[model samples]
Target: MVPKGDLAAVLASLLPAPGSGGLVGADALRCARALGVDGVAVSVTVGSGLNELLWSTPGVSTQLEDLQFTLGEGPGPEVAASGTAVSVPDLVREPVDRWPVLLPEALALGIRAVFCLPLLAGSACLGTMTLQRARPGPLEEMPLADAWIVTHALTAALVQDAGQWAAFAAAEDGSDFYRAAVHQATGMISVQAGVSLAEALIRLRAHAFRHGRPLNEVAEDVVARRVHFRHDDGDGRAPLAGGGTEGP
Candidate 1:
């Protein structure tokens, strides 16, 4: 169990420093681990992208999270949309058909239970803090309390990073790092395949989903002229010729 005073100390220590930004990613995971929970992830929505700040477990991958975003469905989206805590204490035993695609994917990755808490300050939502356990069970009260503490810590960090927030928000809506490449690739694919940009984006996502690769990595390949999206067989796929996909 997490002591209230320890939680307070953790929050207080997180408030002021050059290390604050880095601390935001590790603190919750450490707290969860210390309190004997399985894993923790911190995610924030900036513009149209939900960037995962930190992930503490190997079972849930960035690929899985991208699947949620590309498909525009999942517990993360639901929590972000509703600004409410969503807990699925048992993913394997839950109604299988509810999230058709996500449930099976999560279960395949060995995630048995999940908890999400919205990161909010007043009426504004930053994102969500998600906790996952390998075994199916509910999060005890102390961990939940610590999760709330982590949320408030994130809020405080956001308040401190107001200037950075403005800069990030003012940047082009979908132009961050590899996102711009993805958009450009989407446009190119749309023109090539005789489809709309929306369809092109879906196709791009489908390729990434099918191949189990991150969309950003695939987009980088498309941008650098290393690969091309094709629909020769009525399915969109990128077949690379020479070079391997690399980070930007």
Candidate 2:
């Protein structure tokens, strides 16, 4: 619960009265500062395995979500499964070995602390809110509580509008392109790679990371008939000469 004294300010920052750009607008980014955190991020994972980033407070938050999706491991997607919040006051000391690829990159990004809050609406787990910091230390009690409040408010906001979530999911904005393209590419790769859609998505992520490209960009190439994956173990994806889907 948010302290009453701070509640109004928090609401003003996150659920700003209309015309202030609303929650999906630039004004909402101020919520992180109001809560005393460096950055905040929001991601929605629909039942169909489609994940979209709703809000990324620029800089670190934006990059962090991208890496998490591309690497396919991190607190963002995992928290929804556990139905609980996960907090890391100090990543350097904790060394989240589970996220081997992410650890080094996160450390390089000057991320010393992180807290992930799961956003749940009714029986459905809507998404997650990720709070980040550049310094090492646990989030102070009040700030953590406020983040939870923000998450709850966000879920309610989305549920209240209802139509917006569908529009948000369908629209290209709000990181929808990446999730949609990844889902589409996964299905295509499944048949060509002789693997399941799950495996194909993973393979796509691996290929993108190895080639040092954005996952979404790689997905676009795959969807554009410019790339094809083989059942072969190495270099799962290869360029398709003449834009051919079938190769000799």
Report the error of model 1 at residue 47, Å.
Answer: 6.5
Error of 1 at 90 (Å): 0.7
- Provide the overall lDDT of each model, using Cα atoms, as 2-decimal numbers: 0.66, 0.73
Clash pairs, candidate 1, are none
Using lDDT as the measure, which candidate wins? 2
Report the alpha-carbon TM-score of model 1 versus the true structure: 0.72
For each of the candidates, the C-alpha root-mean-square deviation to the true structure, in angstroms, is: 5.8, 5.7
Worst 10 residues of 2 by lDDT: 239-248
Per-residue lDDT, model 2, residue 221, is 82
Clashing pairs in 2: none
lDDT of 2 at 172: 30
TM-score of each: 0.72, 0.73
Native-vs-model 2 lDDT? 0.73
